[model samples]
Target: MKDIILNFGPPEELETKRILEVRSLSYLERLERLMAIIEVSHTLNTAKIIQTKKR
Candidate 1:
């Protein structure tokens, strides 16, 4: 059996305009960095599940 996770949230497009409006030194840059971290975490989680099932 497989388990699925659901993510209910707003889309990234909403951040597009807001991100562009941010100044160079603003916290929005950190937001983008955090987004990258989130993506990496998701990839690692998926890889771990696949590796576990193969054992």
Candidate 2:
């Protein structure tokens, strides 16, 4: 079974923690994540455009 960790903190604190975690990643890891984000964004935009044209 996988381990589950829980965090209890304010939004600002959580955001800071997340930022720090991302910063800790290597350049290649960060680039891969950014590319995945861009791919998802492009897919969603294409779907929206197709749906709009079908209306």
Point to the candidate with the largest TM-score: 2
Q: What is the RMSD, in Å, between candidate 1 and the native fold over all Cα?
A: 10.2
TM-score of 1: 0.50
Estimate the TM-score of every prediction.
0.50, 0.79
Residue lDDT tens for model 1, 1-55 = 2284554556675465446645444587679767999999999999999999999
TM-score of 2: 0.79
Name the regions of candidate 2 deviating beyond 4 angstroms.
Answer: 1-8
* Global lDDT scores for all candidate models: 0.72, 0.90
lDDT by residue for model 2 (1-55), tens:
2285677899999889889978999899889989999999999999999999999
Candidate 2 backbone collisions, by pair: none
Top-scoring candidate (lDDT) = 2
Question: Once model 1 is optimally superposed onto the true structure by TM-score, how far is the C-alpha of residue 1 displaced, in angstroms?
Answer: 44
